[model samples]
Structures are given as structure tokens and as C-alpha cells.
Target: MPSEWDTHTSVTATGDGLFGAELDPGWVVGGGVNGGYLLGILGRAVAESVPAKPHPLSVSAYYLSASTPGPAQVSTRVLREGGSVATVAAELGQEGVTRITALATYGDLRAMHGDVATTAEEPALPPIEECVPGTMAPEEVRRIAPLMERFDIRFDPACVGWAMGAPSGNGLIQGWFRMADGHDVDPVGLLMVCDALPPVTFDLGLPGWAPTLELTVHVRAVPTPGWLKVSHRTRNVAGGMFEEDCEVWDSAGRLVAQSRQLAMQPRR
Candidate 1:
């Protein structure tokens, strides 16, 4: 059985470099489809355009507006199809309105193996049993953000204070992430995982929804079949805007993905 992430993000060719996709309601957050889920939809179309290079090595997406659950069109243009990597530009639109535009470089992760260097350390976390469930949200928030139900996200104890009305004021979130349905997370799934956690601003005592304005992710390696350790932190916040840095480490202790996004502070 295909995973929900795969099933919902699937795209079908409708000719003219445009693929048909559906925005599943289950992936909605803050009255709009989760940006990561939307990114997956667009990335899938770009992948289909260049099947030889299936993995998204790097992707930068700009959100122009929110998208609702319904039929969506993903149109892609091959910017540069190279031997090792393919660069493509894409747009995800609904009802003739473009909601998100993206550019991506795709490559085969299996074919890349080289030197590894690490200066930054992955956030150390206790066993999943000791962490708090990310799905433990207030009724109102859970009602508007069903995306939480799609994954088994266990937050680091030190990071759960935000949810309990006692934010840590540290602007950091650490957690263990994996599909609740037992499906293996692939390179593309990293898009969703990168943005799966609550915005780090929540722990900084910022309330309400923080919508992403732009997101960029780099896929470093394919994940092993197990849980992924995710950490997101924000070091600056000003002018009602902030930047978030995210890292995902696979079960094999390999760095698989990294992301950074700029978003608005919650309207609250």
C-alpha cells in the first residue's frame, strides 16, 4: 500500500508540462494546505518531467498565497537538464490562481557518495517514549491544523513547554519524526517533514499561526528506514518576521535534509 504522503501528493500528466494534482483536506493547516505538502505536489511534477534525476537535491519555494483543498495544476519547465542534476521551475495553482512558485535541482542520491563533514551536531533527544506527542494540541488548533494527525511527531521534553502555556523563550524545537502509517520516508517526503513541526516561534512566546513566506530545503542523503530526528530553531525575530533553520537526521545517524524558511509572526 502506498503511504498517504505518496498517495495524496501524486500527480498525473495532463499534457503541456502541466500535471494534475489534488490538495487533500487532511493536510490543511491554519485554513490552508500545509506548504510542505504543496511543495511535494510541485516537486513530484518536476520529478516526473525528469525521471532520470528523481531526488530533489535542492528546492526553493515562494508562497504567494494559501491554497484550498481541490484540484490543482502543477506546471513545470526544465530550466537545465544536466548529466548529474536537473534544474526545473514549477508553479502550483488552483482555479487559475498561482499560489506557490518553486525552482528545484534534482539528482540521484543513490549515485552520490563522497566526503562527509560535520561541525553542527544533531540535537540529542531522549527515547521517543519520554517525549511529548506533537498531536497534543488544543481543540481549536487541532481543528484548524489537521496536518498534525498525519505524522507521529514526538517533541523533546525541553521543547514542549510552548504547548503547555509556558513557552521556553528559546525558539527551538527538537523532535523525532516518522510516518504514523509505517511507511518509509523518501527524499521527497523530507519536504513535508521539514515543515511538519510547529513553528519554533511558538516556544518563543509567540502565539497564533506563523505562515511561511519562503522555504528552501537541501536534500543531502536518502534516509534509512526508521525514525528521523528533527530540530528547528530561530535565532532572530524582528518586524513581525523571523527565520527558521531546520535539520533532519535519519535513523542511521546520517544528515538527510536541511531547511530554512522566512515567515511572518503570528497575527496574535
Candidate 2:
């Protein structure tokens, strides 16, 4: 059986056909679930809960309340089912408070066209073996590097050159990463995970401590590449508020997803 961290450990079905899972503390931060991991767990939960075929392509989530530590309860409800798509709403809570809510949509097929926005061709995926190990704090690197157990990554010096170093006045990160499990997962889930990295980048900027306040992802497609490149940048920070944005690309150099986050920095 997958451990609590690998996947949801305990879940129950409701009379209304919704499903709920107890959230584990290993996944929570600031008394709320890590926004990125929550999206992953819930995205996978919804995918497992329903009979949809193509897998979740998009998800939009709202953070309503802070999730308390320890086992949290998750409830999923089917909002709509259509000929080619399905939609679900998920609520995660603890202590009688709804902490997080999400709406996920899945589709069977997407229109493919030759014409779309394109960017300067990014460099080829670098050899993971040749790239230097990331320089993030031991704990943070341990936390995120393990995530690569689920995704394949080839660090690009130009993009992710100094990821662990202090964030320059500009919060920017560039790199390549993809599902290490060797399968395309929900695009939204990809965005959710991708968005999580910037907070660490932002924190690195401070001489002390900083925590994330909000993260948002906008997925453009189900990434088809075995590898993806990222260009993440933070545009502003003022009065305890900071913002970062990430632009991700498929191996083919097509824009695949983008993410943005707002955070509060407190002196450590």
C-alpha cells in the first residue's frame, strides 16, 4: 500500500456519492495543506473517484480557510457530467472549517492545431548526470528533490543555475522538469507542483524567514513532452507582499503551463 505521503491513506465514501480523505500533517504548512500538494492529492483523488477517461486536464482552486494539522477530511462532489467532459468540486477541511475548495474538469480529447503562440526555441534538455545538484537548503532540497521521484528533471544552468542561492531583486527561475513516473498527469496538477517552487526561491531572498500566502496556476495543455523547461520570475515585492511567476515549456518548446504566487515575508 502507498504510504500517506505517497498517496492518500484513508478515504471514505459519502451517501451523496462524494469521497473524503483524511489529510496528513506531513503535507500541511502554516496549519493548512501545502497548496501544491493539496492540488496533487485532490487532483488524483478526483481522478480515482470518477469514471472519467482522459484524466483531469484543468483544475481551479480557492483557499478559503487554513487547514489544521493532523488528519484532514476531504469531500468530493460531482458537479457535472457531459458527453466529452466531467467536472468535480472538492472540499478539504478540518475542525468543522472548510479550508480549501477546488473545481476540476476533465476531457477526452483536445483540439490540435498547427497554429499557436510560439517562443524562441529553448535549448535541448540537458543531461541530468552532467548538471550540478541543486543548491537548496538541505531540508528544502530533500523535500523537492524527492518530488522528482514522480517527475523527470534535467536541470539547466541557464534556467535553474542558482535556484538555491538568494533570489535576486528579480525572482526568476528557469529549469526543466517532467513526470519522473513517465506518464502525463493532470496538467493542473503539474502547474500546482510547479508553482510550489517559487516560495522557496522567495524565502531564499530574505536574510531570515518567509512563508507562502497564495499560489495560482494556469495550465495551457496536457504536456506531451518527456521533459519540460521553465522560466520563472518574480516581478515585485513590497510591504511584506511578494509575487513570482513561472512559465513552463514542453520539450518541444511549446508553452505548456504558467503559475503565479503571492507571499508574505516575515523576519526569521
Candidate 3:
């Protein structure tokens, strides 16, 4: 049986350079669909359209309009195809209205080699078993958002105190993440995991839907198999707008993906 994420991201060729995917309501966050999940659909379309089975290197997505649960069409155009890298543009639409536009670069990671260096260190986190699991009651899931049920997230207890009326006063969240159905993390799966966490603003006592205006993700390497260690933080909030930075490290401690997004703060 396919996991919810797999089933939702699956696309079928509908025509030349065109594909279609069904948007599941289970992927919704608030009244709008989750941005990352929507991007996954486009990523699949682009990956299938290209001759080489290249992994996504970088993806920049702009939310042109909001979409509800339904069928979505993807139109992909290969901007450039090089010996090592390919650039593609994709648009996701519903009922002939464009909802999201994306530009992505893809390449074979195994063929690339360089002197890898990074000053950033992965945050120390407890074992997944020791962390506090993010679970909601049945009624709460119905009231807030059902998307939480699709992910297996074990959050740092210290960072989730705000849910109990205890604000941490710092906009930071660290956790272990995996699909509820135990699917392996792939490039498309990494995209969904990048945005799966609760907004960092939740710890700042701002609890409402924070719609992403734009999101950009860079895939550093293909993830190693296992649960992913993730962290999200927000350092700035002004004029009802804020930015969230997310880092996803595979079980082998390699940074698989990193994302940054600008979002509107909840209007209280």
C-alpha cells in the first residue's frame, strides 16, 4: 500500500509534456493545501518528463494563487538540458487557473564530486524514542488540520511548551521526522518534509495559519535511508511577515536539504 504522501505525489501523464495529480484533502493545512506537498507534485512531473532520472538540485516555488482539494494539472518545459544538469520550469493549476509556478535544476548527484566543507553543525537532538511525539486527538485533528496525521513527528518537548500555554519565547523547533506509513525519504519526500513542521511562530504565542508566500529549497545530497533529523527556526518577524529556515539531516548526519520561506504572520 502506498503512503499518503506517495499516493498524493503520484502523477500520470495526461498528454505531451503534461501530467495530472489528484490533490488530497489529507494534505491540506488550513483552508489551503500545503505548499511543499504541492511542490512535490510538480517535482514528480519534472522528474518524469526529463530523460535522465536526475534528482532535484534546487527548487524555487512561488505561490501565485491558493488551491483547494481537487485535480491539478502540471505543464513542464525543459529550459535547458546539459550533459550534467537540466533546468525545468513547471506550473501547477486547477480549473485552468495557475496556482503555483516553479523553476528547478536537476542533476545526477553521484557524478558530482568536490571538496565538501561546511561550517554549520547539526543540532544535537535526543533519540526519536525519547523525544515527545507530535500527536493530536481525533477531535482536535478535525478542528485544526488533518495534515498532522500524515507525518510521524517527534518534537523536542522544550520547544512545544507553547501548545500547553507555555511559550518558549524562542522561535525554534527540533524534531525527528518520517512518513506515517514508513516510506523512505526521497527527493520529493524531502520537499514535503521541509515544510511539514509546525511554524516556528507557534512557540512565540502566535497560533494561526501562516501561509507561505514563497519557498526555496536546495538539495545538497540524496538522503541516506532512515528517519530524518530536522530543525526549524525563525529569527525575524516584522510588519506581519516572518521568515522560517529549515534544515533536514538524514540519519547518517548528512544535510540532505535546506529551505527558507517568507510567510505572513497570523493575523490576530
Best by lDDT: 1
Per-residue lDDT tens digits of candidate 3, residues 1-268?
Answer: 7766778889999998899899999888778888888999999998898858468888999898888998999999999997888999999999999999999998877677987687778968887788888774246645557788788899887788877878697999888998888888887778778889988898888888898888999998888988899998999999899999999999888888999999999877
In model 1, residue pairs whose N, Cα or C atoms come closer than 3 Å (at least 3 residues apart or on different chains), thus clashing, are: none
Score candidate 2 by lDDT. Answer: 0.58
Candidate 1 lDDT for residue 94: 93
Model 2 quality (TM-score): 0.69
Q: Write down the worst ten-residue block by lDDT for model 1.
A: 133-142
| Better TM-score candidate (2, 3) | 3
Which is better, 1 or 2, measured by lDDT? 1
Residue 46 lDDT (model 2)? 71
Assess each prediction's global lDDT (C-alpha) against the native: 0.91, 0.58, 0.86
Show model 3 residue runs off by greater than 4 Å.
136-138, 141-143
Candidate 1 global lDDT? 0.91
Q: Which residue pairs clash in candidate 3?
A: none
TM-scores for every candidate against the unseen true structure: 0.98, 0.69, 0.95
lDDT of 2 by residue, 1-268 (tens): 4433445434566545455666555544433456677666666667656655345666666777665446556677778887667788887666668766877776543543356766645545467666544433367554633433444455555444344553453455555565544554446456455654435344345533244555556566767746566665666768877766667777656677666666666564
lDDT by residue (tens digit), candidate 1, 45-153: 9989999999999999999988999999999999999789999999999999999999999999999988989787878999999988867778888888888889898
